[model samples]
Structure formats: C-alpha cells, structure tokens
Target: MTSTLALDGIKAKQQKTWASGDYGAVAALIHPMAELLVQSADLSYGARVLDVAAGTGNASLAAARCGCDVLATDYVPALLDRATDRAMAERLPLSIQEADAEALPFGDGEFDAVLSVVGVMFAPHQEVAAAELARVCRPGGTVALANWAPDGFIGGLFKTIGRHVPPPPGISPPPLWGSPDRLRELLGGSFELTITPRDFVFRFASAAGLADFFKEHYGPTLKAFEALGDNGKALYDDIVALADSSNVATDGTLKVPSRYVEVVGIRR
Candidate 1:
C-alpha cells in the first residue's frame, strides 16, 4: 500500500522537485550524513573522484580538502552553480558539471572512485544508475553510496505525514537500504559490497528553528501540498503543528533522528 502511494508521488514530482533547484537548502540537513559517507569512501589525496547527484558539493568539497581531484555532477544546474561557487570560495580544485546519474557523461573507467551521498536513491532508475557508477569506475576502484534507512525516526515521521497527505501519483516510499541484503541487491554483482549503518540526530535550538527548517528545506513537501488545492494549506498547518509539539527542549533544541546506509563497493 505504501509502495503504491510512494511510486505515484515519485512519478508526479520526479521532474519538477527531485530534479531541480528545489532541493538545495535541504543539503545542509544531510551534511552530517554526507560527511560519514565520504569518510567511509577512504579517499586519499590525488584520488580521481566523481560525485553523482552532488548537490552543493558537500562530499566533493570534503574529498577535495583531502587533496582528491573531484568532479561533482548534478542534474540541476542551480545546484551545480552553487557547488561551483562554494568550491571557488574554498579555493578547491573541484569541477562541477550538469549530468544525470543513470546516464553519466564520461568515458568508461574514468574515475578511481565514485561516491553518491543521499542521492542515488532518488534516481528515477536506480539500477541504471548503479550500472553507470560501475561503468565509470576502474576495476579495483571504489563506489560508495548512501541512502536513508527505513523504519528510523525520519522514516516514521515521513510515514506519518504521508498518511495525512495523499502521496503524489506513481511514487512509493523508498526502500530502506540499511540492510546488507538490500545493499547487495542494489550493487552486489557489480562490486564487492560492505554496508555501514550510521545515525544522525538533528538538534534544533527551538520550535522556530524547526519551522525555519521546514520553510527552507521542505521544498518538495511544500510544493506537493500547494498542488493539492485547499486541503494542502490545512495539511501544511497540521504538519507544522506536529513539528511544534515534537520540540524536545525549552532552550530551543529539538533532536530529530535519522539513519543511513553506507555501502562501499569495490569494482570487480
């Protein structure tokens, strides 16, 4: 039932929100997760790295700081622009390009490593994207990917919210990849797979902080609500109220939980 609804939503909004600048601000919320995934890649200085769906270059910049030659690509030009600007500001030699994950615009075996932090699952075609990642990485190169864990706090939250709002057509809620079996299914045959589970606790100083986060980061949710007509505004209000009630500290700190699946695949 959840899968039916989620896929419906994905098909409706995959083009507009998932593949656009709408996701830029949410990048910060995922930074901690990205850092962990990047570290798991075990990158060394001068490594040739490609970051797929590299929104705002968090992982790419982190790799560059370690002296890796990084190329960050995303389908959204606005995200690439922001990522490029950030690289320039930091004086990192990171290249930013606009490209799709399933059909990357690079020659075969072009990179020593490829990483996608909290990105690839959103690919309209995850299997094709996995194949592409395998295609670009030379034998013995590494491919690191991270995805959200289902049944975690964030997952529960989204599930709750999703129950209130009708999901967009054709999108199913994403599968949790925290399990090794699922990771194997996603990238098993193409590379040697290792799965790592990591948790993130988002601490917000106050309810206002949560509100500000929603205002800034929940672009797709907001857009989805708006598209729902009059019911959307009411639903948005309900969501905010729910968030407000979930505030844990009077001093303005709210701990929101998240878990991720970090899969390291050595190209075969």
Candidate 2:
C-alpha cells in the first residue's frame, strides 16, 4: 500500500476505536499532563485557542474551562461528535470542527494560542503539520505540543507491538515528537520552543484488566488486529500472550508506566 493509503487505514481503525467511547474512560490517563500544559500556557481569558487533533477534547475542554473560546478539531468525525457532546454537557464554549492537522481549515493568524496534547505526532506529515500550526497562530502567540517519550513505558509498548506486526507497505509509523532535540528540530524556527519531561503511572486492578484496557484503548494496535487475516490472527494471539506474560505485578495493581515530552513554542 502507498503511504497515504496506509495512513488512511490506521486512521480508519482509530475512528472506530474512539467512536466506541472507550477512549473517554482513559481521559484520566493524560489528565495530569494536560493540566500542566494549560497551567504552563498562562492563557488570557478571551484567548482564541485551537486544539488540533483534539481527541475527545481533553485539552480543548481544559482550555475552555480556562475561559478561552476554544475550537477543537480532529480528522475523525466520531471523535469530534463526542467532543461536541462533551462541550454541551459541560457548558463549555467550545466548537468542534473536522480538520486535518496538516491543513487546518482556519485562516492565517486566527488563533491566540494552539495546543495539542499527545496529538500532533500522529500527523502523517509532521513538517506540514508543524508549519500549519505556526501558520495559524498570531505572532507572539503560543503553540504547545505534547507527545510521548520514545524510551518511556508507552514507547516500549509500541516497540514491542511493532516487533511482532510488520507495518503495511509504504506506511511509516507516526513521527515521535518525544526527545527535546527532536521536538526542537520538528517545531523550531517557526516558534521559540521549550521542552519539559512529564511522567505518569497507570495502575490496573490486575494483569487481565491491563490487557483488556490495552485491547480497548490502544487504537493503532487494536486496529492492526482487526486488519489481520487468518494468519495474522495467529500472530496477534502470540503477541497478546507475550504482552500478558510480561504484565506481572506483585500486588493486584498492574503498574503500567508512561512519560511525555511537552514542547511549548511561542510564535516568532
């Protein structure tokens, strides 16, 4: 498959997973990091904020709560729908839009701030997405991007899965905006960048709980499993077994680890 086709396939799986609402339950997983991003933002009350790839509006909602007029955009309509519902329920002044990160629908310099938590790294073209982010922000406005650390727990999980399941032809994995040097490279020049390390731990009741959570919440892998044929099914089973065996914890709580690199860029 061509690179675009591969990305579409992955996107399709992600839409299905997020549409299931399982993602909403795991919102807490990134809560601390999200709060950090917002607090660090020091946004003004009337700021026009754009939350790109705003999955279920975790960061967008937080920004809205901070009194900013927020626009939450995502490629997946289902995820946007969920975010819209969430905004209505919470009485937040937030609008949902279907927009690609690489090609934002808004005009130039329209937003006072742009924030994405664990979102931009999934863009098929990181450079294009980064440029787009800078393009939409007014001069001196802030653009904050957060992504997982490649050497952290979540990174290890993806590495493990990638080892077992070969990617579809021509489809490279998403760019990881994890390291400080890498984040600077991807996002510098357009904006002045600040990188910080943030970490979190998820405690599951049991290994089985952790497996089920993984099966449900880890969108890409679950989608990969759904894409598999009969032979692929066997391989997926072995992979699951391997993951389960590795999920040993002394007490009942399965301690799954995670870390993030939050990059803040001020428009120059």
Candidate 3:
C-alpha cells in the first residue's frame, strides 16, 4: 500500500498541476456530458446533491438547473471560485466549499445524489475517494459520474502525456473509473451500477490548434510539458499527432470523438 504521506504529496502536486493552467477553456466544451449525468442520476426537485471535485461547477450547475440544491466541493479553492462565479451568474442554488475528494467533509447519508464529471476519478487515492462518494449519499440515493474511457481520446491524450512524463508509481490511472467492471469492483457492494458508453465530440479548427490550445489552457497538458523541460516540444508534437489521428472531420476542422462512460449507481 502507498503511504498516506506519499499520497498526500501526490494530491498536493495534482492540485498545483490542475491550477497551473486555465482548465475552464477545456471544460466548457463538455457541458453536454454534465446534463446527461444529471439526467442519469434522476435528480428531482429539491434534491440534496453533492458535486465532488466539482471543478468549475459543470455538474453542480447542471443539477441546480434541474432544481436540485447543490454543494460543489474541491480541494482547490481557485477552481471552486470559478464554480461560485458560474453559479452566481446563473442564479442557481449551488453552494461552494473547498474539500478533498478522499476526505469529504459532508455527513454520512447527507446527500440525495453525488456527482462527478471528469472529476473525482483524478483523486490520488481512488478507493478512498470512491468510498467517500458512496459514504455521503443516502441509501437509495444516486452516485453518477462521467469518466474518460480507457480506450477513448482523452485516455490516449493522458497516455501520450505519460510517455513524456510518467505518472507517479503505485497509483492507478484515472481512466480505470471509465470501466464498468472496475466500477463494479469498487462500488458494487454498496450500490447497483448502471454504466453506459457514450461519445462526446470535441470540435476544433485543426489538430495543431487543438494541441496548442490544450497545452496553453489545459492543466494536465501544461504540467506534462513543464515536467518534460527541454523535451516538451516532442510532447507537443505527440499531442498534435494524437489529435490528428483521432480527427473524424472531413472538412479540415477537427471533430474528435472521445468515448466516456456514464455511471449511475443507486446506493443500497
């Protein structure tokens, strides 16, 4: 088992990496998945919902829009600040807090639904975070998520990044959350899981443009490049090539389709 201290160190680094670039630019393109997740959770009016690792409030705002009372939490306050701004602008019933995914501050059975969209999966301690997600939900409540499928574009993106700057050892990749079998192994005893594979199209003018945009505005991409130091240019070239290979657009513009799994579980 990984020591708690090392896990904490990884989490600290993750926080900095995610905060390094403007993730908002990348997140804005995935709004549809948020809506789909809210629907999958079947949240009703006045439902008490918790959005874990709710960066920029995509899931929280979506839930609030559907009449759920949402508490959006993350370890990074800067990201939470953006979520707060989004909630305020939309006049939604969403609250903000800085909380770790593995060590959630909410009470047991406190929420009717727990949601994460490309969120909680990134926690350094996967099992602990998964348990925390299940712990806070009321019996029969929903725990819905949208994770990047291991065979998808985003997964390939991370894999490419890993080749340049390998992830810390002793930690499971976040894409594992995208697997239904893995989700069952983690949460099956506590909840009945419903997993669906879906694709979300990411539009861009060109593969090179997309790569540049992500490296400049996406945290993980930026961090990977930073870690690569002088070899960062090769990483950028790899990303451009990856994006180009995944492009399904015929008109020159990019329309890359990334597969992700939508998981909706009912707590037992």
Candidate 4:
C-alpha cells in the first residue's frame, strides 16, 4: 500500500481501538498525573485552555478546577460523553467537543495553553499533531505534555504486545514523545522546550490483576487480545510476566513504576 493509504488505514484502526473499550475507567486512575501537568503549565486563572485528545477529560478537569476556561476535545464521541458527565458532576464549566489532534478545529493562537496527558503522542502523524498543538496556542502560551518513556513499564508493555502483534510499518512509535531529543526536534523551532522526567506508580492486586484490568478497560489491550484469538492467552501470559518483573511491591501484589517525560513548550 502507498504510504498515505497505510497512514489512513492505521489512523482508522487507532480511532476504532480507542473507541472500543471503557477508557474512562482506566483514565480515572491517572488524575494525579493530570494535576501535575496542569501545575507544570502554571496556567493563569481565567486563561483559555485546550485539552487535545482529552480522553475522559482528566487534564481538562484539572485545568478547569484551577479556574481556567477549558475546552476538552477528542476524536471519540463516547469519550466526550464521559468527559461531559465528569465535568457536570464536578460542577466545572467546561466544553467538550470532537476534534482530531492532527487537524484541531480551532483558529490559530486561540488558546492560552494546550495540554495533552498521554494523549497527542498517539496521533498517527506526529509532526502534524505537534504543529497543530503549537498553532492553537497564543504566542508565549504553554503546551504541556505527559508521555510514557520507551524504557518505562508501559513502554515495555507495548513492546511485549508488539511481539505478539506488531504495529503498522512506517509509523513512529508513540514513545518518541517521551524522548527529550525527539520533543525538541518536533517543537523546538516553533517553541522553547523544557523536559522533566517523572514517574507514576500503578498498584494492582497482582500481575494477573493488572493484565485483566487493561484487557477490560484499555482499548488497545482489549483489541490486541481480540485480534490474537487463541493466541491471546500467550500474550496475556507475557504481559503478566512483564508486570511481575516490573512490580516493586513486596507482599505479592503489583506496584509497577512507569516513567514519563513532562514536556513544556512555550510558543515563540
């Protein structure tokens, strides 16, 4: 297939993957990470904030709670529904919309800050997505991101999954966002960049429990298992093995630490 067709096919599959499962359940566990990202952004009260690929609105809600005027957007409508519900429940005045990160539905320089927490890194076209993130922010505005590092637990998990079912060729790995050098290359000329390493700890009853949780709530994991058919058990076993190896908990439970990079870019 042509490169363009390959990209189109991959993006379609990604969209479907994200839409397949109850991501909100998994996203809810990372609210602390969202809060940290907003803190790093140092958002001004009443600032206009845009959360791109805002699955279930964790960062959006964090920004809103900080008193910024927030718009939470994602390509998945079902995820937006969950975001809307969360915003309403929290009594935060935030807008939820459907938008693609590569082609954001907003005017240039429209927002004071743009935030993506484990979000935009998954965009099929990383360069276009990075450009759009820069384009939407006003001059001197901040674009903050939290992306999983390639050597982190989550990254290793993806690598393990890839061993079972490899990703499409010609597409960059999402973990590139976690590399300081890659982030600088992607955003440096248009924005001044800052990178900080951080870790998030995941606790589960056991390695098996962690695998089960992802299989049930994380779309990518769920879809991978579905695609594997009878081979899914083998993949799950690999996941459990990796989880056990990464687990830090002493009492037989799982507590895996995943490192991520916190990126801040100021529009030039």
Candidate 5:
C-alpha cells in the first residue's frame, strides 16, 4: 500500500461530496443493479453479507430480502438513515454501520460475501478500497460489484463535470473499476474475476428534467453545481445537452441507456 498522506486529504473531500445532497433519491433509480449484483454473487440463504459503501442499502436490502444476514455500511450518515428507514418499512433485518470503504471496521474473513454497487469505486484510493473488500471476505467467498463503464452515460457525465471543476490530482478515476484490465491489476492476486457488460436505462420526462433531478438530488451533481456558483447554469446546460444527444426514446420521453460492468470475484 502507498503512503496514506495524500489519500487522507482526498478521503476527507470525498466524504463531504457524498454527504452534500439527498443521494437516496438518485440511488433509487439504480436499485435494480443491486438485485443483479446479489444474483451474480450467488449468495445463499442465511449467508453473512457485507455491503460496503452501501448507498441507501440497495444491495443490502436485496441480500436481506433473500434471507441473507446483511450488514450495510456507508460513510454518509444521511444515506444510512434512509437505508435504515427502508429496511424498517420492509421489515428486513439489516444492520447499518458508518464506515469508510478504504478502512472497513470489521474482522478479516468475517463475511460470506462482500458487495458494492456503484459504491466503493468512488473511494479516493482505489487499491486500498479494493484490498479492504477482499480482506473482509472469507476464503472462497464472493465479492461482487456493479460499476459504471467509462464509455457510458454516467461516466460521460462525470467527465463533463470534471471539465467544469477538475478533481484533485493523483486520484484514479472511479470508472476505472468498470475496466476488466484494471480489476485484474487491482484484485487478481486475491480473487478470480468475471466481468459482464450490462445496461441500465434512465427514464425521464426530458433531458432538462434529467439534469434538474440530478442537480437537486445527486450529491456529487449537487455539489458540482454549488462549486460552479455563477457558472452553474453553464454546467447544467452541458449536462442537459449531453442527455439530449444520448436520448434513445422514440416517443419523446427520455430513455438514456447507461452501460455498466457487473463484476464477480471469487476469493482465491
């Protein structure tokens, strides 16, 4: 592992970024990916599962619904609160913990499966986060992920945001988690990786609606606009234009397909 000095700063900023807005609303749209990840992991009934960086308990809820014992964690307290509410309403047994992906507070080999759906990839130190995921799972257990492909709509959205307000230097792009080559480099020594490409379509009334919804609900998007201040409108315009160009709906309603890669890694 590299020195933690540089990552310390990035980690702090990352926490604030995620905690800035009501991410639960934005996360709701991607909950389906969580079900897919749970299925890909092949979790068995009553298995002990850990959902790291578990935004709004998407994967955690899915696993719990399958009769698995699940512990969902996130650094942002608000997100965990939302997850807790969801679990209560569904009468599902889920334990919510406040934890950082790069430094999980759990015993080694403590879980039957570890999962992250578009979650852990945002950690400031990618390798450290990946190592933590592997460390927490028992030997022969599974680690499953649903990450946005760099060539996809969501990935392109981030790139557009970067043009407006560049991210800190020396941090790996979160979308790298979607790349099979990067996964091999990050996780090969500890696990055997299988990647499957998939698409998740975002339906909205229009391009403007999509952009407005994200600006109001997605933490990173909300924060990006805040940081832009006077230039926020310009950023919003770019996002809407991008969405408009990518809309595939023939009936006028927006249906934007975002490509992502589902990763299943069996511990070596």
Candidate 6:
C-alpha cells in the first residue's frame, strides 16, 4: 500500500500539473465522447449527477443539458473555473467545485449518477478513486466512464512523455483503467458494468500542428515537454513521429483514431 503522505504528494503535483495549461482547449476535441457517455448513462430528469475530475465540465455540461443536476469537480480549481464559465454561458444546471477524486466530499449515495470521462482514471490512487466513484452513487444508479485504452494514441502519447520525463515510481498508470479486467477488479463489487470499446478520432490540420496544439494547450503534455528541458526537441520529434505514424488522413490533415472504453455501470 502506498503511504498516505506519498499519495497526498502525488495528488498535489497532479493538481499543479493540470492547472498549468489551458485544458479546456485540449478537451474541446474530445467533447463528443462526453455526449456519448451521458447518453448511455440513462439519467432521468432531475437526477443528481456528479462529474469527478471533470476537466472543464464536458460530462457535467452534457448531463446538465439532459436536465440532470450536474456538479463538475476537480482538484484543480483553475480548471473548474473554465467549466463554471461555460456553465454560466450555456445556462446549464452545471455547478463547479474543487474536489479530489480519491476522497470526494459528497455523502455516500448522494448522486443518482456519477461520471468521469477521461477524468478519474488519472488519479494516482486508482483504487481509492474507484471506490469514491462507487460510494457517491445511489443504489441502482449509473456510473459512467470513458477511459483511454492503453493501445490508443493518448496512451502512446503518455508513454512517449514518460520515456522522456518518467513519472513517480509508485503511481499506477492511468491507462490501466482502460482495461475491462482492471475495471472489474476495481469496480465490479459495487456495480454491474457494461463495457464497450470505442474510438475517438482526433482531427487536426497536420501531424506537426496536432503536436504543437497539445504541447501548448494540454497541461500534462505541456508540463512533460517543459520537464524535458534541453532534451525537449526529442520529445517534440517523438510526438510528431507518433502522430505521423498513426496518421489515417490522406489530404494533408491529421486523423488519428484513439481507442477508449465506454462504461455504463449500474450500482448494485
């Protein structure tokens, strides 16, 4: 077991990393995944929903648009600031707050549906985050997730970043949540889950363009590249190479299909 102190340190660093760049800009390309997730959650009107580790309220806003009362939470309040701005502009029933995925402040069974779209999977203490996700949902309620698969572009991107700036020794890789077997081990006790493999295609003008976008707007990617220091060119070249190798577009544009697992679990 990881010491509480170690976990806390990891969480603190995560908050800072996420707060660094404009994640809202990066999340925009993947916003459709949130719509797909909310559609499968089977949420009823007036249902209380919690979006854990919500980066700029994609899932929360989607749920809110369906008439569900949605609260978007993340440890990094600065990121939630963007979510709050969007919620206000859209007039959706989406509220924003700073909350940790591993130790959510809400009461057990407080929400009718709990969600995290490419969110809580980033929690270093995966087990604790999974437990909190289950704990906050009412019996028979829904718990939906969209996790990037290990074999996908996002996973490969992380791996590329790790090769340059390795992560802490004990943190569980976020992509583990992409596997059905791992999901079962972590969440099956509390929910009856339906898992489906899906792809989220990323579109950009060019491979180099996509790499630049991520390096500029994605916090984790930005930080990873920054950490590379004098070796930053290697990371840039690798990111470009990864995108170039996976490019499915033919007309001088970038089209990479990243796989993710969409899960809709019923609270048991």
The model with the greatest TM-score is 3
Model 5 per-residue lDDT tens digits across residues 31-123: 999998898888999999999999899999999999999999999888899999999999999999999998899999999999999999999
lDDT accuracy of residue 80 in candidate 2: 77
> For model 2, how does the per-residue alpha-carbon lDDT over 1-268 read when each residue is reduced to its tens digit?
3576666776665556556536666765766777789888888899999999888888998898899999999887877787888889998888888988878999999999999988777776567788899999999999987788887766766666676566545543453678777677777888898888876666777655665676666676565556564545554555445445555567755665567777888899
Which is the winner by lDDT between candidate 1 and candidate 2?
Answer: 2
After aligning candidate 2 to the native by TM-score, how far in Å is the CA of 63 from where it should be? 0.4
Candidate 1 worst ten-residue window by lDDT: 168-177
1-268 per-residue lDDT for model 3 (tens digits): 8899999999999999888899887778898899988987889999999999999989999999999888999888998899988888888867899999999997899999999999999998889999999999999999999999999999999999999889989999999999888899888988999899999998989998889889899899998887788989999999889999999999979999999999999999
- Candidate 4: residue 154 Cα off by (Å): 0.8
lDDT of 6 by residue, 146-218 (tens): 9998999999999999999899888888999999999999999999999999999999998899899999989
Which stretches of candidate 6 lie above 4 Å from their native place? none
Clash pairs (backbone) in predicted model 2: none
TM-score per candidate, in order?
Answer: 0.83, 0.86, 0.98, 0.98, 0.97, 0.98
**Clashing residue pairs, candidate 6?**
none
lDDT of 1 by residue, 1-268 (tens): 3363564455446545654334666776677666777788888789999999887888888888879999999877778888888889989898888887878999999999998887766665556677899999999999988777775655654565677665554443554445567678767888998887776666777545665566446655655555676766555666556556654555656766566678888999
lDDT of 4 by residue, 73-172 (tens): 9998999999999999989999988998989989999999999999999998899999999999999999999999998988998898899989888778
- What Cα-based lDDT does every candidate model obtain? 0.73, 0.76, 0.91, 0.92, 0.92, 0.91
Candidate 1 residue-wise lDDT at 244: 62
Global CA lDDT of candidate 6, please? 0.91
List the candidate 3 regions with Cα displacement exceeding 4 Å.
none
**All predictions: root-mean-square deviation over Cα?**
3.8, 3.1, 0.8, 1.1, 1.4, 1.0
Residue 69's lDDT within candidate 5 is 95
List the candidate 2 regions with Cα displacement exceeding 4 Å: 1-21, 169-172, 228-252
How far off is residue 15 in model 4, in Å? 1.2
